[model samples]
Target: MTTGAIIFMIIAMVTVWGGLAAAIVNLVRHPEASEAEPSPPVEL
Candidate 1:
């Protein structure tokens, strides 16, 4: 593979895994928020 392709692959991998890690941390910090259901819509 080309050097540019390798670099792009590394960047893409980092971005995806970083996002996943952030999501997991947020869920851990706010367990209730992830588990709670949304409220029903109000009647007019």
Candidate 2:
């Protein structure tokens, strides 16, 4: 492969994996609520 292709691949790989890592860290720091807020009754 060309040098540019390799660099682009590395950049893309880092972007995807980095995003995954960030999401995991965020979830660990702030988890979702156990109970969701109740929804209002629907009108006819």
Candidate 3:
């Protein structure tokens, strides 16, 4: 393959994988409580 093609592939890979890694890291650092119950509805 050409140099330009190789560079593009590398950039594309980095962008996709970088985004996935960032998402995983963010999820791990700030996880939500799945078992928390919602408040009951209030009557007017």
Candidate 4:
């Protein structure tokens, strides 16, 4: 594989793993820890 391809693959893998970690962390946190309210639906 070319140098550029290897670099791109590494970045993509890191991004995917980071997203997964964030999701799991969010799920394991207490409900009271959430402070943001859901936004209202937009009328497109």
Query: What lDDT would each prediction earn against the true structure?
Result: 0.92, 0.95, 0.95, 0.86
> Taking the tens digit of each residue's C-alpha lDDT, what string does model 1 give over 1-44?
99999999999999999999999999888787634788889999
- How does model 1 fare in lDDT? 0.92
By TM-score, the candidates rank as: 2, 3, 1, 4
After superposition, candidate 3 runs with Cα above 4 Å error: 35-44
Model 3 lDDT-worst window of ten: 31-40
Q: RMSD of each candidate? A: 3.9, 3.1, 4.5, 5.9
Residue-wise lDDT of candidate 3 within 1-44, one digit each (tens)?
A: 99999999999999999999999999999897877978789999
Error of 1 at 35 (Å): 8.1
Cα displacement (angstroms), candidate 2, residue 30, comes to: 0.4
Candidate 2 lDDT tens digits, 1-44: 99999999999999999999999999999998867767689999
* TM-score pick, better of 2 and 3: 2
TM-score: the better of candidates 3 and 4: 3
Q: What is the alpha-carbon RMSD of candidate 3 to the true structure?
A: 4.5
What TM-score goes with each of the models?
0.70, 0.79, 0.73, 0.62
Best by TM-score: 2
Q: In candidate 4, which residue pairs clash?
A: none
Off by over 4 Å in 2: 37-44
Better of 1 and 3 by lDDT: 3
